[model samples]
Target: MIRRILISCGIAFVTLVANAAPDDSIKVVKGQVSDYYITVTHERIVKGRVLDKNHQPLEGATVMFFASPMHSTTARDGSFAIKGADNDIHLYVYYPGKKIVNKILALDENNLDIVMEDEAHKATAVRRPAQATRWYDPQAPLSRTFCNPVNISYNFEPFNNNVRPNGSFRSSADPMAVEYKGEYFLFSTNQGGFHYSKNLVDWEFVPASFQRKPTDDDQCAPAAYVSGDTLFYTGSTYEGLAVWYSTHPKTGRFKRAIEKNVLPSWDPCLFLDDDGRLYLYYGSSNEYPLKAVELDRNDFYPVSKIHDVMMLRPEEHGWERFGMNNDDEVTLRPFTEGAYMTKHNGKYYFQYGAPGTEFKVYADGVYVSDSPLGPFTYQKHNPMSYKPGGYVQGSGHGGTFCDVKGNYWHVSTCMLSLKYKFERRIGLYPVAFDGDGVMYSSSAFGDYPNWAEPMDIKKPADRFTGWMLLSYQKPVEVSSIDSIYTAANLTDESMRTYWAARSGNPGEWAQVDLGAVKTVRAIQLNFYDHKATQHNRAMDIYHQYRVYASEDGKSWTLVVDKSDSDKDCPHDYIELSEPLRTRYLKYENVHMPTGHVAMSGFRVFGNGDGDAPQTVKGLTVKRDKKDRRSAFISWQPDTDAYGYNIYYGIAPDKMYNAITVLGQTEYDFRGLDADTEYYFTIEALNENGRSPLCKTLKY
Candidate 1:
């Protein structure tokens, strides 16, 4: 006999199983059973994972068992489970705005995997109803600044719904960012254009003024560096990878000189050492090591033999291996590209991005050498730039620069692309050098909007200010919404899906209810460019909106007013000068870049749950003889922690030195004296406060 059970969200169900032992991981419980050989509930169960077409886990997906009301959600790993009461049970996997996935299990089947198709894959004429679940895009279209791809003329999809793999909204890979005259500028290989940001928070698209004819090769991975007052640029091929220069970066035009062969290069950058010497670093591909050669001072061309700095070694480094989990074993070797170098405190730090441009784990790693041309050693904490879990993903192929405040910041690629393997977006992270001279980029809340000011102090203990997520899955109301483009999407936390007004008319608004009154610290009004047509910077004023907060659902008060603000911030983050308490929040749209009144997140961040993180524990330190300059430190992470601080030195009592590892539990101690006895401890920090130090360790 088979029994069918049903349960909904937050509901519980009990099932009988004559299992050898109950599995608590999925809440498999047992009930009355027969004796030994005649156990009434003979062990039988079905469990598996829900994945997208790309084989990536679909977290937070809702799974329902057919006929049996019992079901479990897909975990971060995408696994779901249900009691197997019969030989045939249909399982349905659903994500908001995505196509529904169904699978059936027959007898003798213990594992069933389901892959969900994106509604985008289906034609608009045959689309399903809106399930406004996710807050971000799935493919992660890499088109922030110059979404336009170079070879856009040769595409299959003339009309793509996602707009990511399509024209203008295409790949903008290798965001070579630099600070020039107090403004941040990004050049990429995708569109052969550039982007400029006055505050590192709002990037505006600018056309490639230098290249009149948009030849795909000329714009690929353009390199720029300030030589005295002139900015030198090169990359992509034309007769000889010609050198271009312009005193004004924002002007977007470069004066191209018809010089000759500067050594066939890929992913290249010109680095100026403090001593007035010029060196060139370039190469990208598993076939070649990231090589460096000295550039002549007079003409800025390669003057010496190239030195192979480093190569891809996925066989040893798991992070450099390709695949969603970096465990896929196949024919082709991994890729190593995006070479960048920075000199700090007389030490040369060479950074490289790797493992192909398509992987989620794609990141930037580092190597250290005393000389510009080096026998460089890989830093134990490789992939120094990483943020795989954020709304936007990859952080590889980026540029490191010092802000006007003398603080270090890394601007790397984020978001994603599907039309092309290199489809990507740009992201900024707070970075710092420790007492040991090791450098790290803090990715805590990386995709979240942050302060535009350069932090001159040591990198923040926590990149995120411990702001609790106050409106996740909360009740939402919109003045007007398009069919299926519901209001609840305003607080889903992913940027892929959003709430859209019935039309792009002024006055359309979306509001969120936080359930109860709560203290709000700041609000991130992330507007979306939903299938927007104008790819280039427009003549119209920057996107505009106004925010209001209320104690009850009725009366409202102005909390943040940007109705007249002139800034092109699709991901706009507005920090209130002070914290305010309110149960209801609303956003009124004044105007937008395009016809849709779309919004990804009307996020409310504040201290709703009052409490600091618990103290860190399980501290461990390891010293390896292979590399004498670094120590690897790790500890159990605190769920509530905004970040972790690792303190260490030559003596336990005198361990005054420290480094704050943001959004991660493990940290590599670089610049340490390998032979000296070193002691270390750790502490967890949140917006409220810090926890006590954990047990110390010596090496």
Candidate 2:
């Protein structure tokens, strides 16, 4: 007789067949069998091939499992075999400059073939449906609005071999934007080139360097000026460096204007006056005052002796004190550099960056004079450009210029200083002169989304888009995490902290759950360089990723697809073509240039479903008796608010200066004129919106 029995061994089911054996040793206890064999099955290998649109084999393409760590690269014949779980699996195929292909198949399946299309060519060929709500349009004109930390491809440090032997982070500081022949040209320090744009929205990099002299160093804090049809450029150096000029800067063609500069200066500014005269203003030291000298319009040589213009008086101006918050005075002295001169209404406004570039308090102050070289007097409303608090900080070491619409704008350096002390970015703000001729750049929501083109500037907050942040302190989830770099860092509202995945491989992702279904309009992905290896500018380096949205976390719909993007965007901001009403947003990593998949901020902005925070109460302002230039401002904290914006000025209508303090209820306002009686007010802000402005109080 033959008999068969099924027995449970622990959690496994096993079958036993016996031929009428008299002695069968099978011990069973509590439905568990002792004699049993557990057969383990290994993962199966999935094979695939990647081909181009023309059926040509594409090599070096990456094939990765969506939720598994197993991955493979295509061989010369475009064939790949990756091991994965025996069940159904999701796979992603990625090739540079080609459209990404995603597939869902069983691991037992074989001979998977994916045909990729050219991303650039396909983008141009695809057209949006006439009646559809479009989220993005490559061919359509961009909106007039823009945000701070201008979105350009910031290059890695090219010549810092001594301090950065392995590699440094993306940085560009000391910016100068000038309009030349109806186009705007941007020049900054250590970029290895410059960028030009027809409208400031889109910038095209032009690789060109100055003709260096024997005694000069590379460009650090460059200066550019447009005279007639030619745009002149030079760098900061104690030893004279040659000046270059270019009529067609878009072509990256430049010729030496002067073989060697006549005067040796650092942080130089080449200013061309309305009267056909030229002057150079330069200074970059804590001890020395800014100096100016007339340059001959003919040969670009000094025509007059250098004269001292202005110096830093930390004792008098509280904003000039050196430290992270202008609170240090025992050891460090403030350094004043970046001398920029703007002539308006027959009055010369000399602007300079102060304190320190690495500090959040880094700002630009103005001094007024009747002549280019002055016995200058400090402006009553000083620090013409100040941005002490925001997502990106600092507004120092920059130049100001007028746009095509005759609207004044200031382009300045923003602080990053994470990888290295000089690691930074650039920002642009709308500037205006009051009826009294006092010049001030509107920086009140400085880093928030604002109109990129000219708009009504009657009020300081007129340029703000009113899109409140929706990702602050939100819940987040991730595919993988490091020991320390957890997912919580994503919504901390800080650039210094980041969420770093365990690997840089494809399929790693982070998902954020906005507390409720919010009307999402924009997303800003700020990538952090964690364990990056590249030391210099790499033109081919880029990031590829995909974003998805869903009301429920399980069912996701594609929103932003950049899997084939060729451009490098360290701080990538995307404004959706149509608003997405979803509670969850997911970011899937396709490729990283040099490091692990790390992100400092996965910021989401739009309207909330709830009400704005209530107006703050118990507002108080105490002017320092010993130092009238500084004041202590505080208010009762709101339970629903995440931060406060303190607005103050000499008059209630003129509350032009605003300090954004996040996660705080108090601020030490120090950038004040001693004799000015200021009016102060505070506004509460949260993910929903900003509260109504509190009652103004005179101090």
Which number leads on lDDT?
A: 2
lDDT of 2 by residue, 1-699 (tens): 223344554453334656744544343333653445233334677787889999889899999978777779999999999876566378888888987778877546766788998885343334333222255543352456666678788876654443354354677899998988877889998776888777676677887755354222247899989888888888987777888888887787788888778777899999999998899999999898989999997777888888999899888888888887888887778999999999999999999999899988899999999998787989878788888886878899889988787878889998877767777889988888888889888887787777666464544567788888889889999999877988999998777789999999989999999988889988889888777776555678888788888898889878777776776778877777777899999999988987899998898888888889999999999999988878999999899998888888767777777888888888887766667778999899887889999999998
Q: Rate the local accuracy (lDDT) of all candidates.
A: 0.66, 0.81
Candidate 1: regions farther than 4 A off: 1-171, 181-184, 189-208, 211-218, 257-261, 418-421, 448-455, 460-466, 479-488, 536-538, 613-699
Which 10 consecutive positions of candidate 2 have the poorest summed lDDT? 124-133
Query: Native-vs-model 1 lDDT?
Result: 0.66
True-structure RMSD for candidate 2: 17.3
Clashing pairs in 2: 135-577, 144-452, 145-451, 145-452, 167-535
Q: Residue 603 lDDT in model 2?
A: 89
- C-alpha lDDT of residue 472 in model 2: 86
Q: For candidate 1, write residues 1-699 as lDDT tens digits.
A: 323232445454755445435422233223422212222344457788888889999898888767766667889999987675554467677886579877666777778788888785554343332221122111231122111111111111112343434443324567676778777767776443577766554456655643333233336677878867787777755246677778875667777654654577778877988888988888878787888999887776677887999997665565677664354558567788888999999899999987767765678888999999998998765567865543456677888888788878776766455334554556667677777777777664565434444434555434455565676678998988777778887877555567878777768888899888887766677665555555432345366666777898789877655555555556565555556878998888876767588876777777664577787888888776685545677889788775676766555654544555556788654434444566788878654556788877888
